[model samples]
Target: MRLGSREVGYPHLLAAALLVAMLVGVGVGAGTSSSTYGAFNAAWDGGSGIRGVASDAGAETQVVYNTTEYETVDPAGTVAFVISPERGYTDAEAARIESFVRAGGTVVVADDFRPHGNDLLARLGASARIDRTPLRDDRHQYRAGALPVATRVAADPLTRNVTRLTLNHPATVTANESTVLVRSSNFSYLDRDDDGELDDAETLQSYPVVTAERLGAGDVVVVSDPSVFINAMLDRPDNRAFAAALAADRQTVVLDFSHAEERPPLQVALRALRGSAGLQLLFGGLVVGAVALVARRGRLS
Candidate 1:
């Protein structure tokens, strides 16, 4: 069972160990999830995971796997929170989402970029699009980070118990809708130039960070920042209060993961780089080592 002066064992064991290692790596990767860019179900991590404390609603939380599956949600019985959904929603898919709100269900869609899942907002009769610029309020924030601290909460029912919020790289949510639930402080302004200075071209006034609108029979709440739901921000100020307020009226909560960019041409290349490339290197090493070991030993004849 030993070779190479008792330094090597059966070649088969080495091969088997390699296979098991690869499988274990894949399983762990799938379970914990990588929080690279488009991650939403990252519940185990505190930096990018929302499951830290937000996942403890103690209610039936279902993730919409596909656009068609979103139809199963009962408008009057669920509080669906779609956070920063990737772009592209078919006409039918958009209609179904709007219908959920009209049916007296509370649909909170928090987005941060232009034309990126803004189709649903358009479907709900709102013409506003999310700006990619990171809104900041250095005067009223936990630290000098890009996160904006919203101190001026409106007197709406949604912000009833909530006083201040710690938003992570929030975008400005500008809409014709007059019911703005939360606004960045008077000193806060969009750093469009990214120079850390408020210029004359930029309006030195309060902008909407969260806005609510009425559609048909239901209502839609839009927040500028989605990072508030992350575990890292839950303990700050009244973030938990805001999160609790959103889930208060509904019997169910649906976190839509299907809306993200699940497949891209670039991702195929990345997978090959990680999986195939690594396997090739391992195969080459095994082949070279096997030939050397066999050459060093004489035949059993």
Candidate 2:
């Protein structure tokens, strides 16, 4: 027997209530998240974040989350801060970023504690490599495992007014085209075995952790560690000063978040197809025809 209007309406109401509750739960979870990384993620405070960088320099910051491509942004004259992306960029996106840098924009790529750093470096024409081994300096360490304290740093505007810099288990970097910005102490060694103790087999010498390269009218800065921008370390020594100098420009600062967008490739393709006006109208017509057929029966039998 066909159900009455009241009976069908009751199920609809129940479903609507359940959906509302689920949505509310999701909203609350999103508000409480305190992710240390990811573009435009403001849940973290001074804990692996660049919000301090934006505030100290008095620069307008725009987070790139929904924007699929870098070319969507106008990189006329500004700084692009890309820190510790979980994934590599698409070819189109990489080309756009390179063009932005070559056209007088500044780009800062900082990555450590991961394997994704070289994705952009390989395309940038710079042979600089981020060492996989952890750089350790016992004498100047902030903690075990050689969280080195940087005292012997390069003389540059970015390092100016910086007295103390306590690095995490930072990776080492090398490049012939770039100038070394931060260096390890001579006594430092790489923990090749993951053991805290320095082994004779491990390389014992200072290495570069940060470097900057100038291309065309732009500059590209690469740092071995991205945790230096975290909120917890920004106040340590002259880290805040260091971060402030990166944003010391008149143009806006953009934090690229597209890398962390976790959508699958198939879903991305579907969304692209849905963007077409013809497809939308075709789908709309089909929906209307389905509704008309259902109405002709006087109910969804």
Residue by residue across 93-202, what tens digits does model 2's lDDT show?
Answer: 77777888887777888887676668877776556768777888888777555678766677787677766567787888876778888787887888888888788798
Estimated TM-score for each candidate: 0.72, 0.73
Instruction: Provide the RMSD of all predictions against the true structure, rounded to 1 decimal.
Output: 8.8, 6.5
Error at 174, model 1, angstroms: 1.4
- Show where candidate 1 strays beyond 4 Å: 1-25, 35-55, 262-301
For model 2, which pairs clash?
46-231, 46-232, 47-231, 48-230, 49-230
lDDT of 1 by residue, 17-110 (tens): 9999999886556544344223343453222333323356554565564656557777777777777776677778777777777788777778
- Clashing residue pairs, candidate 1? none
Error of 1 at 216 (Å): 1.7
TM-score for model 1? 0.72
Candidate 2, after superposition: displacement of residue 141 in Å?
1.4
